[model samples]
Target: MQKVVIVEDFCIACYNCEVACVATHSRSEEPIKAYKRENLRGRSNALVEVNGPIAFSAMCRHCKHPWCLDTCISGAIQRLDNGIVYLDEERCVGCWGCVLGCPYGVAHPNLKGEEKHAFKCDLCIDRLEAGLKPACVEACPNKALIYDETMEETEGAYNR
Candidate 1:
């Protein structure tokens, strides 16, 4: 299944996407409180930036040849048939290969900022299972991010 990709060309680099992401994933469903919680408790699911007008919005690629899976000597990362990659936290040795191997720089050493195990977007497998869009994509105001299992159009190729 083809997936949502960003069109940075259209991005205004407003922190809207970032803010939206926090709201989407937060326990309180409010942004400011979410920030305080994430910083104070140091729990996080992902990161966002827009200063480059080139903010990176990313998730696991669930690759046909997944570097995270291959690099994990601990055998913690697993690729599922549904095009989602996940981690077995118990088996993770915190070796950080997945972080280093991730071409997008999305995976990181401490997702919760508490545990040392690396983590990245699991594409919100729960949401996908519910037939719901990823929270980040659903919450983005600029419509900068999108989620689609079926890519019906290649319209962007001609736009640039």
Candidate 2:
């Protein structure tokens, strides 16, 4: 399965990945529209962590056996054949089960609209289907994030 690998040493704490993620998932697919007009400035799936001199970007790992999928009471979380853990917003009941179950704390609750739901990185399934890399990976100017298809899935591989 494909994964977004983090080159922690190369990260510069830039938030371009977060911006690209919000814009890509926005209705207008534009940074300005997504942030200003759509009020989605901080609703990015990709999160950038900065600790003094060290920094890195993180998102859903799409684990082989996702706890989010198992804990979803509404059956909104589904693991596709490609190993991507997807959350169907329409089916989500705002239960927050997936949020509490996610080991990485990447699953987020979407309370912006009238109906609440959950959201997370889908690895940009639409972009992948269109033969393109995820917005976060493509927008990293320092090449800190890598879309790696050859990554081996081992237990606690993300502990690094």
Candidate 3:
């Protein structure tokens, strides 16, 4: 399964990943346009976690057995064959079941006002379909984020 690995040593806390996530997910899919609208209130699916000098970006883990998938009363959350966890926002009722069920606390409620919905990382499904890296991983200047098949392989590559 494809997974994003955070290389904590390389993280600089610049928040570029967060910016890229919002831009790509925005209505216009443009950074400038997304940031320009006062009502836009773009939210990044990936969050930059900080603890003093230590920081790293985090998103959905696409768990082997997702609690969010099981807890969703509306069946809005589903797991793809390839292991991506997807949310059908049209079906979401803002019950926050998934939000509370998520162990990593990545799932959140969308408060942008255009629509009340739940949001989390779908591993940038559109970009994955186009054979491109997730926006957040591509935006990292220090290469702190890595997408790969396994943690061992990802770590081995970074170690060298």
Cα lDDT tens digits, model 1, 8-60, are 55555555655655565567868888888655233334455556446655555
Report model 1's TM-score to 2 decimal places: 0.75
State each model's CA lDDT, in order: 0.65, 0.88, 0.84
Global lDDT for candidate 1? 0.65
Each candidate structure's TM-score, on Cα atoms with residue i matched to residue i, is 0.75, 0.92, 0.89
Q: What is the lDDT of residue 57 in candidate 2?
A: 89
Clashing pairs in 2: none
RMSD of each: 3.6, 2.0, 2.8
Query: Best-fitting candidate, measured by TM-score?
Result: 2
lDDT, candidate 2, equals 0.88
Segments of candidate 1 deviating more than 4 angstroms: 19-33, 38-46, 49-53, 152-160
* The best candidate in terms of lDDT: 2
Which stretch of 10 consecutive residues in model 3 shows the poorest summed lDDT? 151-160
lDDT of 2 at 5: 82
TM-score, cand. 3 vs. native: 0.89
